[model samples]
Target chain A: MDTEEIYREMANSIVSLDQEKAVHLANQALDESMDLLQVIEKGFGEGIRKVGDLWDEGEFFLPELMSGAQIMEKAVDIITPGLQSSGSERQSSGKVLLATIEGDIHSIGKTIVATMLKANGFQVVDLGTDVKAEKIVDEAIKGDIDIIGVSTLLTTTMVNQKKVIDLLNQKNIRNKFKVIFGGAPVTQGWVDECGADGYAENAVESVKLVKELIQ
Target chain B: MLFTNWLEDKSKIILFDGAMGTQLMNRDLEPGKIPDLLNIENPEVVKKVLASYYDAGSDMVQTCTFSSNVVSLNRHNISNLYQKINVEAINNIKAILPSEENLIVGDIGPSGEFRPPVGNASGDMWKAGFQKQAKILAPGIDLWHIETISDLQEMSAAIQGIKEVSEKPIIASMTYRKTKTRGFFTIMGDSVETCVTKLEEEKVDVIGTNCTLGSDQMIELIKELVNLTDIPISAKPNAGQPRLSGGNTLYDQPVEDYVNDIGQMIDLGVKIVGGCCGTTPTHIRKIRTLIDSR
Candidate 1:
């Protein structure tokens, strides 16, 4: 197949959530001496972007969205080493620290955001769920992260997202990183009320919000 | 005390209690502390929340074991305390009940773990997690209530797990978001028809929707549910969409307004009703007045 044909098949593989096909295409592209970064950006990345659009349009749901992300991740795994061994690494958009704020054990929303952010070229450090504000802020400082994404699916735990921002300001380093809020209960108004930099309603929007914040 | 015949009085509407997480916060639960731990560490608080609901005329109040299931507890490194948490959660409610006439729902929330294609967890994993909790909670509680679940697969596993342990009446509720496409759907993309079909196939005593949508939004969804299922329907919508005020999350839907919306739900033939996130005893009190006056 031609280079463009291979890329189309790769994109289709993710759009269909066909992981085996995506992996096969990734390997085929490498064997044909294709540019690995192009395989990712034009092929798998294009597919994930389409999946995100379908998610936004309500044509896709959480399972489809997460499955698409997982497929993209697997395809990228097959392609990344080729780029690295060839010393042609793709530039990351920015680094983000993601967590489900403390007191909330819900992690699906946060995990979807992490997967989408990673698929969209952001380096993500997931702190997992029930993370304390101190630990979140401490990691933000330690990692020199560009953005902190705090999420809580429970209404009661929503306060801890604000707590993370408060801890940052208490340390007098609020300006050092952009803080974005997410989860079912978070709103744009809540983000503003809590002094957060931004809020995204879902995983698809999280990528766009994180990108705009870093910019 | 499986009250398998609990719904025999078709004329009387069964009232479930309001939100546990909301009451816990009002009682000064810290931002990061696990709510389930309160069962073992602070039984009084859990009892107080249930007592207020009972006083407000809730015929049935759920135990504070929503997040004590193995999968969720494991995330907090308290998986070993799962059985203990479930036991104490039921004990706390039993201690405060005014009489045996009032029902105690053994509340179960989602496992927070997803199955295949989307997540690594399997149906068996979900079944095991729920079964473990059900075994501990079934002995004390009168019935089982599984709520706020998004995936039908998980719901099926929950039903199987609970049924494996006891013959309690199961109230299966899934949380849904109102879509712009003229219907309500769970976040997992299960449509109302799909939800109704699954719950019916599982032979649950109650089929309903809860969380995400407010009472106003729930009116339409409950209307749809009433049309689809002959089984008793439950509507436990959020007080409304939560809004942040002064750095604390609050549900701005007023008690009168919330009860009014619930009234519409009752008119549409909803049998089991209560609040979800952000509801308190005040909302339940008004609902009690509405039910009695009706």
Candidate 2:
């Protein structure tokens, strides 16, 4: 197949959520001596972008989004060695640290956001669930993160999102990284009240929010 | 048998208590604290909530065990209290129950653990946790009420778990979100038709929808649910969508608006109706007035 055809196939694999097809295409692109970076950005990257659009349009749901991310991650894994051996690196748009605040064990939403951010060219460090505000702020500072995304599904736990911001401000480094809050119960009003940079309703909007804040 | 008798009259409306969590919040249950722990920490407070629902004219009241299952307790570092929490949740309600005429539903919420590709939580884990809760709660509860689950697999697991422990009638409710492209679906993409088909296969006594959507959207979902199954339908929609203000989450849907939409749900042939998040005893009282007038 032509290079353009190969890119289309790679994109299609992700949209269809076929991990095997995506991995096969990634290996094929490498065997054909294709530019690894282009395959990732133009091929798999375009596919994830489409997934995000589909999600926003309400044609896709959380399972589809999570599955698509898993597929994209697998394809990217297959192509990573090739890029390394060629003395090249895939440039990330920014680094984001993610967590589900203290007293909340909800993980699905936060994990989807991490994967979606990865697909959109952002490096993500996910601290998993029930994370304390102190630990979250400390990790952001330690990681030199560009953005901090805090998620919570419970109203009781959402207050921790504000605590993270309060802790950041207390440290006098609140402006060093953009902080975005998300979860089922989050809203723009809450974001404003908590002094967060933005609030996203779901994983797809999370990617857009990060992009806007980072820029 | 009691459950069957309550539903014997096809035209009679079955009224359930409104939100347990919402009532607890009103009672100054600390935010972020595990609500189920109240059963152990302060049984009186839990009993008071159940008594209020009965006073509000609810035919059925749910136990405060929505999060008392093994999986959720483990998440909160209270795994040791699993059996105790489930037992107390039922006994606390049973203590203040006005009479046998008022049914006690064994409230079961989601595992807060997703199954399969969504996460690593296996179906067996879900089944085991649900079975344990049901086993402890079976004797005291009039029926099994599993609500707010978005995943079909998890819902199936819960049914199988409860079945393993008891023969009580089961009411399985899934939460749905209104989509822009497709009509309505669980966050995991289980459509109403799919849910009905699966719940039927399990021979569940009732198929229902609760949480995520407000009373108005629930009216739309009930229309779809009633068309898909012969099983009795139950709906427990939230007061409305949660909004954030002044560091608190509020469900600002007016009681008049909520009760009016509920009136529409009753007209749609919904056999069992109640409230989910943000709903109060006042809402249940209003629903009682609506159902009694019929």
* Least accurate 10 contiguous residues by lDDT in model 1 chain A: A153-162
In order, candidate lDDTs are 0.88, 0.88
Tens digits of lDDT, candidate 2, B165-189: 8999999999999888789988888
Off by over 4 Å in 1: A85-87, A132-135, A170-172, B1-6
Which predicted model would earn the best DockQ?
A: 2
How high a TM-score does candidate 2 get?
0.97
Label model 2 with its docking quality class.
medium
Write down the DockQ of candidate 2.
Answer: 0.69
Q: Show the lowest summed lDDT stretch of 10 residues, model 2 chain B.
A: B241-250
| Candidate 1 residue pairs in backbone clash | none
Show the colliding residue pairs in model 2: none
- Alpha carbon deviation, residue A59, candidate 1 (Å): 2.0
Question: On residues A1-215, what C-alpha lDDT tens digit does candidate 1 reach at each position?
Answer: 78888888988999999988999998987898798888889999999999999888777898899899988988888888888889998789999999888878787788889999898888999999888999999999999999999989767778778888889889999999999998887888888888899999889988988888898
> What ranges in model 2 sit over 4 Å off?
none
